[model samples]
Target: MYQRRTAVRRRKSRLPSYAFVLAVVSFMLAFAFPPEQPDEPSARTLPVRSLSAAACSVPPPVSQGAEPSIPSSDGEDGWMLTLVNPWNPLPEDYACTLTRLSSGHSVDERCYPDLQAMMDACRAAGLKPVICSSYRSREKQEELFQNKVNRLIAQGYSQERAKAEAAKSVALPGTSEHQLGLAVDIVDLSNQNLDSTQETTAVQQWLMAHSWEYGFILRYPNDKSDLTGIIYEPWHYRYVGKDAAAEIYRQGLCLEEYLEQTA
Candidate 1:
């Protein structure tokens, strides 16, 4: 009887110890191998669902100052923005002080410094930029216009047709920008011809890219010919002052477009 009772007591004691060991093993296993958690998103790996929602949302309104303000045309630099075209001829009272260049060409004295700096920069950059034509008297303009008309007539165009065609290529004497002394025909020394081919020259490429830095802009662009009322003459550049030039360049605007916006 005594042996049986001792055996029962020993069995009960082992039961409690066994339970304790089982609990400890479970705790240790939990610490060693924790349950998996969901992954967090990074900026680059944002959830697709969230991204879709964002993409569908309405865009924020543009700020008031988002677009650049057009410069004032009535400011002290008003003369720099003078508009000369077929319709707007040079005023009878218009006059500018002339500054002659080494090549016997002249530009407006007001724009001389910028013009000189532009040419200096071009030469410094290993370019051979030449001012082939600059300021022209009314008589010179008339002669050039007549020469164009004569050439067209020789090509079998009627006198009336030739006159109209010539005016398109060469501005009518009174309406020529050359008379204002703010425009110049710059050409690469390698190719002195004034045509679309000039756009391909190194000197022209440089001027097109950087002329605004020196207060000039390509006077006529190929696509803007309708608005400018002149064919694309890539060699021709006009002084509009640095402020207007920079804005015009940034906006991909021709001189007429820039003036219209400010007006």
Candidate 2:
């Protein structure tokens, strides 16, 4: 008569096998799923798009951001606008050609150290540029502006219209680029003439196309009238340093836009 008694086994049953199973499960998860990234936000975070070209080729649409405060009337907006649309190279900060049309039209000797160098470059490059206009005081601008207003009025323009028209080319004293003595109008100096070819001449053309090399720019271009607030002056070149001019010309951005970003 044998009594059947069940004894519990105390021996460890395959500890390594349990560990191997856990390792397999971990490996499967590692292959099937990716670990979280540091840059990625948590579940509660709102997703954000990256700014790289792959994510957004163009800038986010404007007018969606908080609006800038409206500036006051006394050039408050003018400052914001001017800051937003700065006139680069401010006057005479950059070296450029200063031509003398008459006896009184010479640049201060210091303001023209590069004249000889510029002349040498022109001669070496076979560029014959004649100086057309030069330094004008604030009084001169007033005089010139009045003259333009008078002439326009004589041509059947209303007084208001004449004044506005004259304002374009003749800056209201102290605001003229020429006053800084760093601007000039150059053209083919052949026959010692002042008038440039309406289109850039071979000489002027080359100069305009490569003016940045000498720290100059065409000053005004048709495409940037709204920004420049001046008519295109293909012959006009203002010295703004080689790097700045190169950047300006290369980017094809107007002085206003150029100044804005820089400021």
Could you tell me every candidate's TM-score relative to the true structure?
0.73, 0.57
Candidate 1: 10-residue stretch with minimal lDDT: 1-10
Question: Candidate 2's error at 138, in angstroms?
Answer: 0.9
Backbone clash pairs for candidate 1 read none
In model 2, what is the error at residue 231, expressed in angstroms? 0.2
Against the true structure, candidate 1 reaches a TM-score of: 0.73
How many residue pairs clash in each candidate at the backbone level? 0, 0
What TM-score does structure 2 among the candidates reach? 0.57
lDDT of each: 0.76, 0.53
* Residue 118, candidate 2: C-alpha displacement in angstroms: 2.7
Best by lDDT: 1
Best by TM-score: 1
Judge candidate 1 against the unseen true structure and give its global Cα lDDT, from 0 to 1.
0.76
